[model samples]
Target: MPTRLLLAFALLLASLGVRAAAISYVDEVQPILTQKCVACHTCYDAPCQLNLGSGEGALRGASKQLVYDGTRTEAQATTRLYYDAHGEAAWRRRDFHSVLDAQGGQAALIARMLELGRSNPLPANAKLPEDLDIAITRSNTCPLPGEFAEYASKNPHGGMPFAVTGLTDGEYATLTQWLQQGAPVQEQALTPTAAELSQVEAWERFLNAPGARENLVSRWIYEHLFLAHLYIEGGDQRHFFQMVRSRTPSGQPIDPIATRRPNDDPGTTFYYRLWPIQGVIVHKTHITYPIGSKQLERVRQLFFASDWTVDAVPGYGAQRRANPFETFAAIPAQARYQFMLDNAEYFVRTFIRGPVCRGQIATDVIRDNFWALFQDPAHDLYITNAEYREQATPLLAMPGQFDDIGDLLGLWRNYRDKRNEYEDLRRDTYAAAPLPGWSTIWTGNDNALLSIFRQHDSASVRKGLLGEIPQTIWLLDYPLLERTYYQLVVNFDVFGNVSHQAQTRLYFDLIRNGAEVNFLRLLPAESRQAYLDDWYQDSGKLKMWLDYTHVDHRTPSALYLPGPDAKRSFAGQLLSRYASLDARPDPINRCSNGRCYREGLKAEQRDVEQRLSRLASRPAAGLKVIEQMPEATMVRVEFADGSREVYSLLRNRAHSNVAFMLGEELRYQPGLDTLTLYPEVLSSYPNFLFNLKASEVEDFVGQMQQVSDAKGFEAITQHWGIRRSHPQFWFYFHDLDARIRETQPIEAGVLDMNRYENL
Candidate 1:
């Protein structure tokens, strides 16, 4: 055909909406983006909200806006040429595909960069496109002397691989070639790695442990244990990201690498990585997060058990081996009165160390420090700092344990013998210390000091209860340290909400032991010391064994999956089935915001409350009467079946300043000195909705105990805030109604269980 005829045919096709050939987006554009852009242009804090992390992010073309708000950032980024041409949102909306066809013009950022070595049209120190008051359309208007000059002058990426030197000829060619060929992301399985083979193998054994199902070492527990940050690279089938320990075993520092995997398998994809998370356990995986297991076989498998056998748990002994609930479970439900009276600080710190994260932070600081390993065996650790020394004295008995100003203060009495600084036998030099207490231990490598600390097996929990908190309790109690403590009791927060706005009804009373702990915590420093000293005066009592009680309350409430975990158990099934996410259907994805989801739960709780309230109809029988005892406050009750029970109460009267416990309802006769704690009979479910507020129990108790009747109950509960929605209300309602019936007995004609129709 003639040239004129060919042109006419192309125009005819254009009229029919047939598009011209363009570079492939996956093949061409993405390569340029992934290499030159994504690193700095991330979500949330990207310079201009131009998220290039994914192909879609790039195509979206800057989901945020530009500002002339005169911020510091605007001033620093001005010298770079990345903002010319495609930098402007309106210019980029024209699309890179058209710019690719145009090849080299001011309209295309990529086109101009590609011309670097080949042809140099942009002049020396050309003005940036965005800098110009007028909109940019093409190249010569902003020419550079050459591509090399362009890199030195403006390419903040230093042209291609933005460095002081700039990209090599071969490297620049590869980028240009990919853009010309079209950027195609090769689709395949995510690659795996053998780097942490021993770790991964341990995980496999743990998952397939002997009796994981019956013992409940299920998928839900694994998700609750650890967290991971990883990703999969596009176009490359073998490139996959995996996590590794932050440092190596040889005391050699190893920066945690974004590791590559060998191959991908469905069973291996998106897993709870067995990376050696940082902590103080030598030859042992120190944290025990899957709460209630007798042996925690799931996580225990990853740890080397030779040094940490059932008989030897390093320092705290096997029975009290580390677990998230190790400290929480050990609390004698009877201790809110018994053992706590012996050592208030010991009891409170032990209680606070219940959570895994807090314990991990505490252990991280003291485990392998100079003092922890080499401190004089019989010497007393001093506290001249006056801040942390006062707070952490309980756990700092060892060398690595004391508060360090990185100076002579944390040093032992024998600093002269080992380090051999003879300047002044007593004095030593110290530098500014690491900020967060967890860091000062020199974690980057296996220093000789850490090795010494590791060998002794001397790690202990850092519950600030017995710990003199250098600052405050903010360090240990989190998730549990929210404002909800005041909210739940005041009944002020929304039904399913977490904030602490006050309302009319309160629902929760604090844990009894927590109440006693807080009472002492609130005392003046000297008074507290005098009180603790007084308790220690009762030598025989202070020496009693730690309560061996064990239990866990946290449960799965939401799905913990990037995609569905096919092996999900009951908790996973419910959460995934009910609370999916934004893009899914109702009942699965469900509810718009957290408040709405909580409201749904609140509604269900209301229904259950109404049903349980009927049980309170009959006159309260088996009600106990509070009787003050010479040794402790006592409550004695006669059952309908002619059995008598007595319970030791920290406070018998309905006082706001006491925490409530199930031990207060134990079966008893007059002669026993012990309360006969039914360790297995758990009164509350320690799930997230409940357990997150563990630290706030005493505060909750004081508010709740102020009123005894329904009016008082409503006032304490913040107008029955949780109603039937929270499981706690069910327990509280039953106990409170029984108390109400006992205190104010109904007439003979009142409701009874027998009055209901028999099926």
Candidate 2:
């Protein structure tokens, strides 16, 4: 066993193709799962509560209970992976069944499941059999070890990868071999580099600094950024850490305070610490934020350098914790406003993607696609006038204080009345002193303008106004922005009973109305009511409830220009003002007036873009295919030189108004629906994927345009779509993932396929 002899033997084994069993689970096997399995297995909607994002989650195994049950009468016990339980035994005590066999035998459920998929490979290059249900609402068929024989016999297609193509041969072998070896938990500890350690120390010291002002500031920062995957700027980007409240201070082992909400009482003195995040980063929940010496200096300037004093630190009581205005009022309003304006996209994402993994009720309050603009702090009435903020404080109280269903009616009444009073006061203020032109709009930085896209249950937010002009626009000021953060991110409870969820949704309705009304105030007085009527047509009695008449008609907008389409004119003016910050003109859709070409695109890519641009021009009303298309479809064009590019085809469904609580389908206006084409992936959840060769681009576009029925659509899909059962599904997926990482390394993660459509 000398060193030279050992090296020779290793070379001999490699020559004979005898692979060793020392495969790194963290480096190899976990990556396969992340790319192929984690899509449907990470969040609350994870199938059977089986989370495969981490080693701990894999060992914790699966549960029969559903985490997102909407019919529950009371809050369910939280089963957060890292917090609720620590080991296999703790999970077993809570009724979770193991998927791995301790004996390193073939009896392991995971092993058998993989073997089943290998033995019964899906039909190649075809639609999945109807028997295999892959819908998001499908029933959980979590077969236990004893029930595997019956389950497989009944549904042979149901395997580890589920309805999708099975893992690659190499990936299958690596995973099966690891499982056969008792699935040893051989993940290495993610030790920080010296620089990372130094940065962590500096951050912990700054956060745990003594004094009431510092304590209040740290608390505020933590509550806002508890969900952020923070990394030290210019350090290892993959090595992200979370800001956690630990009972132990810096240099000690973190004893994290596992509270339901970030602001919940820790029941002890806690220090903010940087805890290394250990898992595969999933796009659905990953919100990246950078922290460094520069960020530290910026925060100091925004909060500490300013002349402000914290009279006392706020308590974690429900009333005080639920209302940010009440809690952080002592902080200079301009400082707080600018802090969020600096990273408005990150804060907006906290509310849009932070609260629930899948929430139609919460998301349905706003339109599918909208542009959001913020109000400048200097021009914001609430931020400049103390009396206005004092009056609005009581009206801003959020829901979820208590989780009783009986409180819904009473809470609704209280919120409704207070909202009405606040609206009247706002109208009177604006009437007394109208906004001076576009002065109210925050034009400080790129984050001032935002684009939000709702892909049904899930959504995404990106900085800079994107796509064509949207149907609705939000003009948020300091008070409105603060209220949105508290209402959606702080108070929303995914595990709460029906009442809590409903009230959160109800409160957001008011916030949405306020924003839309604020935007309407910028239009000419005569055009305001007409716009409201069009936006809320066929809303029925809900119109009366929403109270659209409260808009400020007495105030004439200083920026008003007389035109038939005032909205379009106003949007054009704003876009012209921020033209420097406009997103890179998309080669596919934005080049309609040009030759549909860009400097970086190759000749073939330019040709493909020109052909595909036709799909974006199809009239929404006559194009029957629009109705059949999924919310988001990623189209990949493979070139002759083996290079490829991906683009997103998003269907922006039109609605009369996003005001109603249920029956969302009734409000759909197919005639007004439109398609937005982006020359890159724009959503975390893609419902379908279509792969075509550069030569086939024109044909694909032609087929898509001619599709008038389900049968015709199926024909088009068979030719161009990468259906779940296609033999090359994994290949296309890996290519798409690589392209995303290459283009957007800082923002990319494994795209979730839970919503990947059967069509």
Candidate 3:
């Protein structure tokens, strides 16, 4: 009887152990962490300096916040990520907080923050029955801790997921069960897959190619110098990468924040912020995520462009400046060069597409257009993103004999200031490009700069087509062209890769607030030019602006977004975002627009989807040109092997859609992502490039067939805005280079002699 009893007890103990084992880091705890926690906590500057990336990071704990620090007497803590590491060190929840103690040793802080909001009236003081002296407050968890008594009086459930929802019971149990069983990491973290490794290696090989390295070196120099005041066509007022739309402080109304726009376009914003940190000359290479165990460094020596001997920096009036580029430039020249050559992978990864000819312009189009090869700049014409006139004098007007509000003499007080400094800069730093000089009062009248791209042969037609293909001879420094090229080739992302479904989605961007129509024509031509010059610089703003305005504008009626009332504005339908509910419209209802618009969109969506459905999934082979218009406006196509026949974009689209979308825009069916000129748009291109005699029989059909390699013969069944489907689309660097090389006008030499792909 005793032995049987003992065996029963042993079996029960074993069952509990097995159940605990099931609640592991891999099987249970991590899933909860990944879904509920990691998104907000993973980046370089994790909130409160608390990194929850791994078990070790969570255990290492959260740093003491700057909000509680006695340095400044204000409640305004920085809303953004705290990047300055000196202010905080992560503190372990085990040592300072309650939940870890209750869990025996498992202080998964995430589970703790989450646990607070699970129960409704949050145990008296935002604490569990077990919580003792921990500083997590109950009164306004604006995420700051106060004295003990304050916990009972203020907002109790302020801990985490803040305004967002909390984890489910099963998720909570999995995490707690794992922690109770000693939160050990049950399995190994994933390594890079075979495909990922192969992709990285391919990019590395291309970047290290001799031409790619030299191109990178040149590019780094140009961005560092030129971005500050990249020449706008008319403005003496130079532009810098200044924040146009200021981030609204938390608790502030959203409409106030949305109203402000920047003075100038913020394109080339990344170029201004190249040297993000000062100490490390080699930047930490960031690849497409799952940043594995190994980290790579890029030799940042190429980024050093300025002669640092000069004093009185561009933006800082009286303050002395430190040149972050000094340590790298001080390195032995050979060593510096070798470093760049060795770390080609890092350079390639960071290389992004350039602003000019950004999206889908053909590389050989220049060869087909007015081809000209001008020589490289003799020496570096260093440009900086510095501004002037505003910074020449002190900000506050000083008293000179008389000081009154808006006094003329007081306003003019600082005119005498920095006069000599400005003179020296002009004399020494801004002197002639080939000779010694200082900062000149550049009024965009530097004739030498204009004459750079002005080739003797193409002098008459210089302005006719160019500024399409960027010229470095016109560039103060040409290497920037290469650097931008390499980065873009590696990734080539443009505009979040978001193709808008409706014109309503253009709010914030392209669309200003409450405007009936979003058009560039609304602004003056000069303003339009200014806007275009700096349009793509702020990727973050562009995406956020897109996402925020996307939902509000989805309904056909602009008045549909009924302010911030959660109940009315919220479309409760599952899987439907923003006014997608198919509720019947009531004439008496204040928001009838929502219901009506949703139904209309659904019907339209169905119609387009059905029209698209008529398309055969795969293209019929050997499609032949039966007939085409002599002017090349419309063409008739027929399949040779099969009876499949169709007319699509080549049938009904306008000149703008075909020329810009098909030719310039990168968004096209894989095989068809090449330029075949439309007659209307091709009037500008030199006629000598095309075989005009072969126009009647073989205008678009032959050209499209040749470019598509028989792949795009599949008539696009999908709609462009509604539900566009595409073939295996690729802008593969190697393949693109091959095509460009093959299609190069042999009659004319290369326009950009230093183009990395050609090299």
Q: Using lDDT, give the best candidate's number.
A: 2
The most accurate candidate by TM-score is 2
Candidate 3 stretches with Cα past 4 Å from truth are 1-19, 43-48, 67-112, 121-154, 185-321, 324-380, 383-759
Can you write out model 1's per-residue Cα lDDT over 1-759, one digit (the tens) per residue?
A: 654455455556556866545545555555444444443344222333444544434433332232212122211111111222323353455332222322333323443444442233222222223332211111112222233345435533223221112233443444444444433333222223443343345544554444423123323223222222111212122222223322232223333322111111113213333343221111111212211132335234423222322321122321221111222222211211221122222222222222111121122212111111111111111212324223322221112111233332324333212212211111111112211122211121111011101101112222111110111111112111111121121112111111111111111121111122222322232333443333222321232112111111121112222333211232233234323221112221122242211124344332322222221111122211111111121122233444322221221111111111222223222221211111011111111011113223344334433333454533433421322223242232233223423432220001111000000
User: What lDDT does model 2 reach?
Assistant: 0.81
Residue 344, candidate 1: how far off, in angstroms?
Answer: 26
Residue 616 shift from truth in candidate 1, angstroms: 68
For each candidate, what is the lDDT? 0.25, 0.81, 0.26
Ranking by TM-score: 2, 3, 1
Badly placed stretches (over 4 Å) of model 1 are 1-36, 47-174, 187-190, 193-205, 208-221, 224-226, 229-298, 301-759
Query: What TM-score, computed on C-alpha atoms, does each candidate reach?
Result: 0.24, 0.94, 0.30
- Number of the candidate with higher lDDT, 2 or 3: 2
Model 3 weakest 10-residue run by lDDT: 750-759
- lDDT-based ranking, best first? 2, 3, 1
The candidate 2 region of ten consecutive residues with least summed lDDT is: 583-592
| C-alpha RMSD values across all candidates | 31.3, 4.1, 24.1
Error of 3 at 411 (Å): 23
